[model samples]
Target: MTLFGGLAGVAGAAAAVRGTSSRRISPYDLLLMTAGTHKLARLMSKDAITSPLRMPFTRYRETGGPGEVMEDVRSEGSLRHAIGELVSCPFCLAVWAATAFSIGFLFAPRFTRVAASALTAIAGADYLQLLYAQLQQSAEGTS
Candidate 1:
């Protein structure tokens, strides 16, 4: 959950930065991105997660005149894939919608206003992106 929350924060920051650089993103774009991200996440699973070999660990040692010493450490663990099977799952979408609603309602006037505004912007951006994609497709078809 924390991981997802952190990612959401990054997404929010990205949206803010993008808005400053150019026209505010449309809600459509936000929807598309969210969909895409959810899809990608679903494709990932726990079994897919893996840890890097040659565990890099720093060790401190007492040195008479030098700085410090390092020791080698080895551990065995299973790879945990962050992406779950939520991409194709409708449950993921339901959870997202529910979570958003919960947050909006719980936060109400305090944070809801900002959250709603952000969501609207995202939805607009998403719509624009979708429209652009469709336009591109149509153009290609005519050619």
Candidate 2:
């Protein structure tokens, strides 16, 4: 498990560096990758930071005015809506499910935790790269 974790960390760091430097990731792709990484991290660390990453669609909700009121009324409803959408969205759900499954498999005594950890790390790296590219493009366009 330790070896796997190390490999994952290294891979994730490498991918993040490359992605940030290359500037090739799209917004949607970045979101998916971030979501996956967060999920993976949460599974491995049993931490709270992954909460925000798990539900990307919720971030789109309006925060004020009638929209806010509507959001408030429908907050639970929105969660359900988001879950349904997440389950249906191939790209988003794939990573979400993969991370969950990997975590589960890793905990089984006989399963290979290191490989799972490494896989999550690779996913995280890809996501970081995507995020980097998106940020780079946005920065360039604004400049």
Q: Which is the leading candidate under lDDT?
A: 2
CA lDDT for candidate 2: 0.46
What's each prediction's TM-score? 0.33, 0.28
lDDT of 2 by residue, 34-115 (tens): 5555545434222233334434333333333211211111235766665635532445545545544443333331242444
Residue 49's lDDT within candidate 1 is 22
Segments in model 1 whose C-alpha atoms lie over 4 Å from true places: 1-90
Model 2, TM vs. native: 0.28
Candidate 2 Cα outliers beyond 4 Å, as residue runs: 1-111
Which tens-of-lDDT digit does each residue in 8-82 have in candidate 1? 676556646655323333465445445543333222211122112112221222221111122222222222222
Instruction: Pick out the ten consecutive residues of candidate 1 with the lowest summed lDDT.
Output: 45-54
Model 1: how far residue 63 lies from native, Å: 51
